[model samples]
Every structure is written in C-alpha cells, then in structure tokens.
Target chain A: MIELYLFLFIMLIAAVIATEIKDLLAAVISLGAVGFSVAIMFILVQAPDLAIVQIVVEILTIVIFVAVVFRTTHIDETIGKRFASTHILSMVLFSLFAFLFLAAVVQSLRELPRFGYATMRVASEYIRLGLSECGGANIVADVILDFRALDTLGEATVLFTSVIGVLALMRKIGRKR
Target chain B: MRGMSLVVKVVTNIVVGFIFIYGVYIILHGHLTPGGGFAGGVIIAGALVLRILAFGVEPVSEKRAEERASAFESLGALLFIGIAFAGLIIGGAFFLNFLPQGTPLRLLSGGIIPLCNIAIGIKVGAGLFTIFLALAAIKYVMED
Candidate 1:
C-alpha cells in the first residue's frame, strides 16, 4: 500500500539525514525518527508485539544517544570535510548499495508467506498444544520461556557480561599515586 | 552535572513512581500480555533514566548507584540460571517446567515462565541503568 511505501520512504530519508547532519544531537534525533517509522511499519504489517519492542528499544537507544552526545562535546571531526572527488564517489557507491539493499528487501518481503497462511509446520502445533503442553495461555510466552529458554539464558548471560564490561571500563585504570 | 528545571524535576518525581509500577505490571503480566521480560526491563530502565536526567549526576550518588545496579544485574542473571538448574535437578532437563502449572490465564498458571520473566526484568532493568549511569555526566564523564 501507499502508506507502507510512504513509511519506508521516510525511513530512507531519515537514514540519509542522520548520517548527513553535522550536529550529533540532530543526527541522533533523525535516527530515532528512523526507529519510529520502522515501528509504524511493523504495526502496519500486523506485528504489534514487534512494534512495541521496537518503540521501547528505540526510546532507550535515543536516551543513550542523548547521554553520549551531551556528555561528549565533540563526537568527530568529519564535519569539516567538504565536497570532494572521494565524497562524490562515496555518495555514488552508497546510492548503488542502498538501491540493491532496498531491492533485496522488497523481493524478500514479497516472498514471505501471507498473513494467516500457516507457513511453519510447528505453527499449528504451537497454537493447539501450547496451552495444554506448556500450560501457558500466551503461546508466545510459552515459545520463549519454555521452548526456546536456552537461547534466552544465553541472551541473559550476554547482557550480564556486557554490563560487567561497562562497569569494569568505567572504573579508573591504574591506581592513584 | 546540574539538575534540570524545577518543573522537570517535579514532574519526574510524580511520574517516576508510576513508571516503576507500570514496568513491574508489564513484567508480571508478560505471560498473558504481548510484552515479555526484555521489554518490561527496558521500560523500568527508562523510568530510572528519567530520574537521572531530571536530577543530574550529583544527587544520584553515582558510585553507590552503579554498584547497586551491577549487583542487582548479577543477581537477576544468577536467579535465571538457578531456575534453569533447579529444573534440571527436578525435571531432569534444563529449563523444565518444574512448578505446578495452575489454570490458564491466571498469574500462577505459567509454571516457571513468570519467574523467568521477573528475573529477566530485573537483569535488563539493572543492566540498562548501569549503562546509562556509565555514559551520564558523572565525575568520570569527560567534561569539555
């Protein structure tokens, strides 16, 4: 639909602007806009759960971005670079890559199974046996916490390790004399 | 870093409690609702970050808060692992449904899922707040 395409177009523009902007805060804001459009696209495609996750994650990302931007005055020195032959070449290459990426994404979207089409073999089983077998009314919760719990465990470990890394890095290196 | 405007601080004071409750609600109802642990954790972290933003780094007592966050985050991760290992002990498999599953749609119906959600909520919330504190304009934060 036109609305879907419109959202995609906005996302594309936001991506471009996010990179092109000189101010770090402006760039972060534009990237947040990109996240917003993607969340809307998720909603339009009948994935409300994904949409909720996307928006919440996006908000947190923006918060982090703002924190970094405000804490660090100068993010980079690349804004000084002006129009040049390399810049022109990079722009052309980026455009070609973006075109190819969009083409592949569109093709994959078209190939995806239709809504309510029951594509996966285990999909029906989950719908039928999830409540009885897993004893959870929400099939999604059952799938995550029961069926794919090991994966969740690994994810938790990863988060824990990353937090540890952050804590370690935040501590001052070397002892005071 | 200094705190924001008085209005922002006042609004944050009122809204933060509501945000914390909402985040807990999301985690508790995750088994029945669309959201789950990670999403709820992020919401909880958002609430804490809001307070940090309004009050700034000084009143937050950066070092102590960071330590608490790290501790809570590890506790959550350990709790999740303990649940899985407990399942292995009783059910002879990792992450088995060890608890007595009650009727569907009830709070106690999800066996170990609710506990897992709560653990994830704690881990994620604490972890994210730690990250925010690290990047925040604290004493260690590089000032221009």
Candidate 2:
C-alpha cells in the first residue's frame, strides 16, 4: 500500500517534470520515467501481463520519441521565456482542472474493491474450467485465444489495417520508371 | 545513419540473437508462459530496431528488406484468417479449436492457440519493422 503510494508519487512528479521541462529530450526521458512508474504500479497490482506489455510498449515508445527528437529540435520553441497574464490565467485554470480530475479519480478509487480482493464474476468460470476446457495452463492465454478468440481476431485485423494504412501513406514511388 | 562505433556493433551482434530467440520462445510457449504473440512480436521488433540503429542501413537494399517485411506481415494476416476459416469449416465456428488439445501445461496443449500466436507474432513483428522502415527516411549515411 505504501509502495503503491510511493510509485504514484513518483509518477506524478515525473509527469510534472515531463510537462515543465524545456529540453525536448529531457522531457521525453521524464515521460519514460512516468511510464516506468506506471508499469511498476501495474506489477504491484499482480497484473504481470499488463506489466510486461506496458514495460515493452514504454520502451519502444521512448525509443521512437527519442528518435523523433533527435531528428527534430532539442529545445521547445513554443514556450516563451517571459510569463504573461494569459499564462498565469491558463496555469490557474489548469490547476483547477487537475484538482477536479484528482477528486474524481479518488472517488472512483474509493469505490473499487480492496486490494488483493478480486471479484471474479465471469473469471470464476474461466478459473474453474479454463484448463480442462481450453487445455492451456495459462488462464490468460486460454481466455484470450480460446474463449474470446474472436476478439483477438478483431484486434489482429485492426493491426493489419493500420499497417496497411502506414504502408499506403508512406510509399516512395507510385509509378514504375 | 552509418554504423555505430565498433564497440556498439560488437555488443549488438552478441546480444541481438539472444533477444530474437527469447522472443520466439515467448511466442511458442504462450500457452504455458506469461507472454504471448503481441509481447513476443514487439520484443522481436525491438531487436530489429536495435540492429538497424547499431549497424545502420546498407545503402541499396533497405527498400528490398522493407518489401520483404511487408510481405511477411501480409502473409501472417492471411494465415491467421485462413486458420479461422479452417475452424469455421471444420468446427462450424470461427476461431474454433479444430486440432486436438493435448494435455494441459504441455507445449502443444492448446489446439489453435499456439498457431494463432505464431501468426500474430509474425504479423506484429513484420508490421512494426515495416512501419519503422517506412517512417524513418534514413537514406543518407553519415560520411565518416
């Protein structure tokens, strides 16, 4: 519990640093830190599947972001050095919105079941019959591949479509020479 | 982007094979392990990305390599759909377990799951590598 809070605190600080920093590369690194903190929190909640995916995705995204930054500029040119009245007003409004968002999150968190107490409604069946029915040792794998396989198929289709879209958009030559 | 320093190239050469094998292990052992196709595929793509970043591009063949990756990606998607179609024909349901489900905790336990994982692994690895290759216009190598 305390460790969770510590991670949340680290995440919050890193997110703020990511937003506030002027160096684009440093900000991207800070964002990576925030992602790692979230991955840690996912592990603490006993969701190794989510943690593995999150950690790998985080690393790949950070790599992409760094690549982009290296190709572009290092400094953030949009933010001005001098503060203005509109800046102060926007900052105040942003703080208020953040406070409201935090309140809503806290309320939702309070409504959730206590830690280590998973209320398995449909998962109860998966636990009881997953191995015998699907013949897979990993229940998560069985659920994704056997029980809800259509969903996986749909996801694969979506990925395929996106790849096609990328390929179509980035073609170098349209006609043969 | 030319090849990195000698030290980086040597290290990458030593480590990339392990990463690729580990990714395949994760995909093959999806039913008995924590990782599956998507995770394994991403890891493999990461290995490819690492290799490209370390060794840089061979000036003339990157387009051909990218085309090969695109072909693999399409082939994977086609294979996945083909498997699902096979299930529909045999079991009267899409994505059904048409093959015999071996004993639990075994490598070949899940009937169609491992097959699906392989298809997805190929699709995701090839798709991501294709995207990286397409997006990064690293045409000019750094003249030393």
Candidate 3:
C-alpha cells in the first residue's frame, strides 16, 4: 500500500539522518529507533519471531554503543568526510544493486506457485497429528525442540560461546590493569 | 556530577522493575505466547541497563552483578545439557520429552519446552548482563 511505502521512506530518511548526526549519543539513539521501525515492519509482514529477534539484538547493540560512547568523545567530527562524494557514489551503486534485486524478487513472486493454502493445510494437519503421535502439547514447540533439536543445540552453543567470549574480554581488561 | 531529579529516579526504577517482571512472565509462558527465552532475557538486561543509567555505574556495582551473572551462565549451561542427558538416560533421543503430555494449549503443558525456556532465559539473561558489566568495566578502567 501507499501508506506502507511512505512509512518505509520515512524510516530510510530517519536512518540517514541518524547516521549523519554530529552527536554520537543522539546518532546511536536514532539508530536504535531505526531498528525498532524495521522490527515493526517485520511484524506487519507477519514475522513476529524475526521482529522480536531484531528488537533484542538492536537493544543489545545500543547498550554496547552506550558503553563505548561513555569512554569516547561525544562529538563525531568525521561524519561530513565519511559521507563525501566517493562515499555517495558507492552508496548509489549499492542502492542500485539492492533495488534490482528487490525488483527481481517482486517480479518472481507473480510467477511463483500459490502454495500458501497447501502449506497451511499441511501445517494444520501436522498440528493435529503431532499432538497425538508425538505426545507434545504444543506442536510448534515440538517441531522446534524435537524435530529440530540439532538446530536448537547449535544455537545454544553459539550463545554459550558468546558468553565465554565476553567473560574472556573482561578478564583481559582486568589483567591489563 | 549534578544530582538526578527525584522524578527521573522514580520513573526509571519503575520502568526497570516492569521490564524485569515482564521478562520473567515471558520466559515462563513462552510455550503459550509469542515471547521466548532470548526475548525475555534481553528485556531483563535492558532493565539492568536502565538501572545503570538512573543510578551511576559505581552505585550499580558491576563486580557483584558480574559474579552473579557468571555463576548463572555456568549453571544454566549445565542444566540445559543435563536435561538433554536425562532424555538419553530415559532411552529417548537426546533432548527428547519423556514426560506425559498434559492438555494442549494450557499452562504446565510442553514439559521440555518450559524447561528449555527457563534454561535459555537464565543463559541469555546472564550472558547479556555480563556483556554490559564488562563494557561498563572497560569504561571505568579507561577513565582511570
């Protein structure tokens, strides 16, 4: 819809403004807002899981930024130079490529088979049988924990590694002192 | 540094408390709701950050929070692995749900899911909190 496009346009403008801002703290806050806006769009498109992940990651990133900013100068003097003519040229090229890719995707969608109905039917059937056969109360949870346990395990391992990495970084800082 | 306004302190504390409570609720009801462990954990960490912002870093006590979070992180990882091992001992596949299936779409249902959510919540909350504390520690160190 026109409204959706308009909203996206506004968000893009906000993102650029945020990045161009002179104040580092304000820029970080604006970037967080941009992330939230993208999360909202994701939810509007019926991707609640993705939206939640985006919001969480963005919040963490903002926290990290705040921590960094506390140690650094607030004024960002490089913004103007960073967005020079060469940078603008590269950005234009990047945008062109992205636009082309999106156009191709939209065009392909018209020719794609209408599998939404079939997918829903299969999912509903799975929900019914999965409960009885698998003896799991929540079908989605069953699929995630039982059927795709390996994926869950891998994700958990990644989280564990990141935790260790953080600890190690902190210890290194302590050692330096 | 100048003292903070009373209103700001009160509002920040209230918001932080709300975030913490909501995080716990989300983690507990993960199976029946949209929120899960990661989301809940991040919300809890956000609350910690809010506290840090309202109160100064010195008042927030990074050392104490780090100790607790590190312990929680280790415990969570151990518990998660232990649960998976329990499934193996029960002659089911790894991470299998050996418990009886209660009524669908109800609380206390999804045996392993609830347990997993709890483990994940602890792991993520502690992990994220540790990261924040570490970053704050870096700032403090650099200042000195």
Candidate 4:
C-alpha cells in the first residue's frame, strides 16, 4: 500500500517536472519515469499482465521519442517559441484543467465495479464458462481471439496500415516519400 | 545510436536470441499464460531494436530491414484475414472458430485462438520493427 502511494507520488512529480523542464531530453526521460511508475502502479493493483504490456510498450515509445528527438534539427525551437508572459497564464490554466480532470477521474473510479469482486455479470460469465466453452485455460486469450475476434482483426489492420505508412514515408525517392 | 561500445554490441548479440525465443514462447503459450500475441510480439521487436541500438543503422541495413519487415507485415495481415475468411467459409460466420476445440491445457487445443495469436504476433512484431527502423533510418540519414 505504501509502495502504491510512493509510485503515485513519483508519477505526479514526474508529470509536473517533465512538463516544466525546458530540456527536451530531460522531459522525455521524465515522461518515461512516469510510465515506469504507472507500470508499478498496475502491478500494485494486481495486474501483472497489464504491467508487462505497459512496461514493454512504454520502453518502445520512449525509444521512438528519443529517436525522433535526436533525428530532428530544432530540438529546443519547439518550446522556445512560446512567449514568456503566456507561460504563467498557461500554467494557471493547466493547473485548473488538471484539477478538474483529476476530480472527474476520481468520480468515475468511484463508479467502477469493485476490484476483485464478481459483480460484473459478463466478466463473471467469462471467467466461469471460459474454459468450458472456449476450451482455453487463459480466459484473456479466449476473450480476445474467440469472443472478441473482430476487435483484434481491426487492431491488426490498423497495425498493417501504420507499417505501410511508415515504409512509404521512409522511401528513398524523397525524404518524406 | 552510432553503434554503442564493443561490450554493448557483444552483450546485445548474446542476449537478443534468448529474448526472441522468449517472445515466441509467450505467443505460442497464449492459451495457457497471461501474455498473448501483442505482448510477445512487442518483446520480439524489442529484441531487434536492442540489436539496432547496439549495431547502428548502417551495418544493420535500415533499407533492407524495412523492406523485409514490410513484406512480413503484409504477409501477416493477409494470413490473419485469410484465416478469418476461412472461418467464414467453413463456419458461416466471420472470425468464427472453425477448427475443432480440443482438450484444455494443451497447446493445440484452442482451435483458432493459437493461430490468431501467431498471426497477431507476426503482424505486430514486423510492424513495430518496421516503424522503429524507419524512424531510425530517417534520423540517421538526416544527420549524415
């Protein structure tokens, strides 16, 4: 429990500093720190599976960000262009929005079905009959590939499209080809 | 990303094979474990990325890798759609579980589940590698 709070506090600090930091590299690394903390939070919530996926995906995302940052010419020009006077106003606006979003999220979390409880009928049904009907020991595998297959197919299609897009963009004919 | 030190290259070479095998294990055992195609595929891509990081793009042939990854990505997507269409042909519903569902706890028992995992694994692995490779290649070229 204490560890969970520690992770949350680290994430909060990372978020604020990552945004406030002027250095792009530092900001990117701080954002990754937040991702790591969130992964830890997932583990604390008894979602090891999610934690695995989150950590791997987060690592890849950070790699992509680092690659982009290094590849680009104007590393600091992005945030440097913003007026100094507007920074104060934007910070105040950001704080207000962040607080509102946090309140809304907390309210939604309160409305969620209790964790470890079997109140969700469809989910309970999946757990109870998944092995018998789906003929698989892993209920998650059964649900994604058997019960919710169309969604997976859509996801695959999107991945395929993105790959194609990247290849096209990287064509040797032109830089943005 | 200009090919890390010699020690890093040696370590990456030694470890990447194990990571690739582990990813395959996770993908194949999706029916009996927590990890499935996406997690396993990402892990596999991570292994390749590790190699790229240690070896750099010039030696790795970013162009060649992108072409192969693109081909495999297309193949994986086609294979996935082909399987789904096969199900529709056999079972009269798209994405239907057409194969016989065998006993539980076995690798080959999940009908189309394992097959889907394999397809997803290939699609995701190749796709992610391609994306990273493309970005790295562009960055490398622009810098040069």
By lDDT, the best candidate is 2
lDDT per residue, candidate 2, A87-134, as tens digits?
889989999999999999999999898766668677788888888888
Best candidate, DockQ:
4
Candidate 3 per-residue lDDT, tens place, A1-177, comes to 565576698788879888789999998988887888888887776657568768988987987787678657799998767778899899999999999999999999887667435444656677667666544554555666656666877788898898788778766444654
- Of the pair 3 and 4, which is ahead by TM-score? 4
Show pairs that collide, candidate 2: none
DockQ of each: 0.72, 0.65, 0.52, 0.75
Runs of candidate 2 exceeding 4 Å displacement: A174-177, B138-144
Model 2 chain B: worst 10 consecutive residues (lDDT sum): B135-144
Superposed on the true chain A, the predicted chain A of model 3 yields a TM-score of 0.67
Tens-digit lDDT string for candidate 4 (B34-64): 8888999999999999888888867356788
Query: lDDT at B39 for candidate 2?
Result: 87
Worst 10 residues of 4 chain A by lDDT: A71-80
Error of 1 at A48 (Å): 3.0
Give the TM-score comparing model 3 with the true structure, all chains together: 0.80
Task: Write candidate 1's Cα lDDT for A1-177 as tens digits.
Answer: 689999999988999888877788889999999999999998898766678779989998987788678867645568767679998899899999999999999999999898678688887887787888777777878988998899989888898888888767666555242
TM-score of each: 0.89, 0.91, 0.80, 0.88
Is 1 or 2 the stronger prediction by DockQ? 1
For every model in order, what is the iRMS? Answer: 1.4, 2.0, 2.2, 1.3
DockQ of 2: 0.65
* lDDT for position B4 in model 3: 49
lDDT of 4 at A39: 90
